[model samples]
Target: MKKSLRTRLYACLWCLGMFVFLMPEHTNAQGAAPSEHLVFSFPADAVLKMHKVKIVQSAYTEYFEMNSFTSGYAGLQQTPDSSKGSSHTLISSLWDPNTSAGIYSSVAYQASNTYTGRFGGEGDGYQSINPYNWVMNTWYNQVIRAWKSNGQLYVATFMNNLSTNQWFHTVTLAMPAPSNFLGSGNDAFLENWDSNVKWNGAFVRKAFFKDCWNLNTSGVWQKHTSRYFSANAGDSARNGIYDRAFDAGYDSTEDAYYMVHGGSTTPGAGFGTGRTLTLPAQTNQGTAPVITAGVISSVTASYASGITTVNWTNDNTTSPQLSAKVEILDAGGTVLYTQQDTLPQKRSTTFMATLSAGSYTARVTVRDIFNNLSAAVTGSFTVSGRGTDTTFYKFKNAYSNLYLGVKDSSTANSATISQYAGSNSYNLQWYASTQSNGSIVLINRRSGKALDLPGSAQTAGTHPIQYTVTNGTNQQWNLVVATGSTFLIQSNMSNHYVLDDSASSTLQGTGIILYAASGTSGSANQQWYQESVSSGLSSLSGAAVSAALMPAPPVTASVLQVFPNPAVNVVNITCKKMNAKMWIWFYDVPGRVVKRVAVTGSPMQVDISSLLPGTYFVKYGNETVTFVKE
Candidate 1:
């Protein structure tokens, strides 16, 4: 071959050599290697079907021209050189002291002495990312997966760039692996092909290898134990550690699986000392599937026409073989509908179900093939004919199953409130108003009062009180929707403060107070499951409160409530939890008691058509509330 042609051919051959690097026939030799190199070997009889390895490169160092190559690699192989009759594949990072292109990974395989295969190129040969882009002292994770496909063995390699937080697409090797080539064992090696020369001190600080897992024919990932041996240990001619290299094992603080033994470059030099070496172990055990509730990363309900679709994303990277189950529940916590299915390792799944114009909760749970179940995640939604319906709601604590209500249904300033077991009462019903500032105010449907923090106190342990709506910061709360369709009422006065059940007490009248919110635990105490109720409707005949419309509060209002204010014809007066004898006096702007009506059961009618069109106020006892008559 011509000089130029020969150089080209040698370059091609070297590239191909990366994948099919020299496989020595060591009869019993495990990870033993030359002093200037490191090799890690798995236990005897261990079959490696998949491997996840990470490495942090050493800082750059000047290499003499005499040094032909410095390389690192990982792959499946048959130990005991005689095992070459079996199958083997390797992905190698090779560097030539004379090359300008820096470093690259190439694929090489050998099923038999005569039928070897090699394809060489830049790191892009099988991966989109260039191995040359690897930064020194930065961790990089690489995984090699092997499986039998269509009666042939195949291997694909992938890498995760820790710095960029992105995973490079898998580079599938083009060569076909032998059909019967089940990897007998796995190995990782680092080498300096130079000889008869050494730098004064440790040239490469250290290389780490940890988090080793092997897939078996059973399709289960099993952890592997690694063993390392220095080449030509104590050999003077080979410059073994004390000669040229040396290594130590079981450095508990330094590594969990394996650690590299650093060495000085000088001939007959001592082993490198005081070098810190460690590779943090990625999760070892299989990870259960992660179930997210709602429409991708949120707990709020996602609404649609005629039906509510609940969506969730599953993350089972650690355990790809898994299944999932989703459940939809009504206010009574009964599982009205359920869907059970299996999905590919990581996926987004949705559950679409028709609900009878009511509020419902959706929960999803996932389990790995190993039978480990994930925590159940939930979100909520309402199925209504009108999507724009922003009806009033009463919150019931899931733990206690009690409705949140104002004390005595009072209209007084700063009236204390607590959780109560109630049904079909107006005091427990609350109107939720989303303010311009992104906060929410929970107003009592009966008193029209805002849930407040007294004097806007910033300290913890303050009991939440209710007062007529003033739109004060003390009265404004933030609805923090958490998993399980539960919401935490966080105070606007203090972002960290939240409405919590006093000591998580389940007894009725237990004070609902404020406490510092946490990322997890206290959230349950502050959480509420919402049940929406339609606000009163209007009619020309006379506005009447529908029995079905008011269904959460335990106490009916003790005062009068008028609908379709500015009434042109008849007006309806609703007296819930009210004394039938208490007289309600309606006054016009001139302060004259124009009408004195006797309080009665709900739906009491007052013919306001005879009155002038204007605003009026209704009074009872020393308290007064207003309404418009337009």
Candidate 2:
């Protein structure tokens, strides 16, 4: 039907006005808020990669992009919809290498509760999304492994929740031929994808990225030491407004680089659109999941079963252990057996061997998933085929004629071992148990403790103490026959260390310590005489023995004297009780002999000019007197 020209013109004008009203007022009216990027440059030879990110601040409709390679990007996002229950998610996407050539990326393995589909808003690609309730102020580790599989390049994504010490595999994607590997350029960014201008730039978003590393073709981890910070252009062609609330720089407190945008953030000095920051060089290849050393609690050897079991524990609270290396060595420091334990959380291992009687040491070390090894710990044991001895006997120092007894008769572990006068108390009596390795464990009859070398100390002048019987090699001693009925008690851990009366002192409470063994005959202080207990004395009870013990006598007076106490060239020594020829010995403070002379008469003169200027002790008979040489 025909209509009036004015009516038609009015309708057309109304349609044109509506079209003009719907059009965008500016070119970037629908563009998102300012987006900041942290571009990282890696080594040219890198193949595998690892990175970390910690979101210090976040807002809805924000994406904290973590690892962005040449092919695609992976990051954490806070979705705009909170009522849908999937407020936070993890995303990984890869662009089609050659869309025009028909080459595309396809999903090889998709994890459960994850979505895989096509995305095309920014670029033609495939992406995987999984609901991840990531919290703020927590660190997350991401690792990407790339390899060629079946003539196609495959990349697998793994994420670690550092707070929970749990690892999750998101997905694996494969690209068609011609895409042989991941690109060398790695980057990250903080993005505001919200188009709502009023709220997009109103909230704050910040994150910290650090410990970036790439595994090169040679399998060595190389850390990225330089990075550049840049932001999207804010001109009319890009986003309509320049964002002054954006900053990116190194944070010394976190030992990482930080990026912040939105909510009145003022860029610090020298932080412009494109600025390169040089970071300190790292000494370690990568972070070690576990750092504590493995501890060995107890080690035992069974002669009947020919088995040695070692018990240990590890601080695997953060990372699971990969394996344990166990080594067993004989007394001669020769390695006898080695084993590897691969089972996680396995705390015990056994070594079976037809071992001859002798002392052996066991050493164990642990390794974590990151190939970090812990310090080694050691233990010792002995295997004996003979029966244990039950008879008790007293051990007397051949030089001092004093009996070895537990100090104060205390039954506690680490009780001091000292020499005391003879007594019927059981603390002075010990029974020797035979081991397959020809070593003996000396068990104190009263305390039921064995003489032990505490902590397996390898230093000289370490005092021997009594501890609960554990059959440890430190508690076992070898009885080497010396002159007459005296024997040298050598520690099973090392033959060079032997029991000795400290300083050859005759004091009632002089300590018994381990010292270097002298010659085959041994020094007088290193020699001991084992006296069998009489049947009558062995039948006494604790109360009876305590009552029969006598108080120690006062120290005897010296019968020797020295004149010219501070002598320069000569000194005179007189012995009031001297009757016949006797040997006089001069000893230094360390119990080492300095000079010796035969005194045929009293008031004998001796030259001292050769001696160093210090205090010296002269011994005659059983008496000792000090004199000064100037």
> Top model by lDDT, which number?
2
lDDT of 1 by residue, 444-502 (tens): 87787889888778687888888777667887776654432356677888455877787
Task: Write candidate 2's Cα lDDT for 283-390 as tens digits.
Answer: 343542222333334343333344466666654343334467877788998776676644333456555334567787887777643445767778788877642334
Superposed model 2: Cα runs more than 4 Å off: 1-33, 82-85, 177-180, 234-242, 272-630
Question: Which residue window of length 10 is worst by lDDT in model 1?
Answer: 61-70
Number of residue pairs clashing in candidate 1, backbone atoms closer than 3 angstroms, sequence gap of 3 or more or interchain = 18
TM-score, cand. 1 vs. native: 0.31
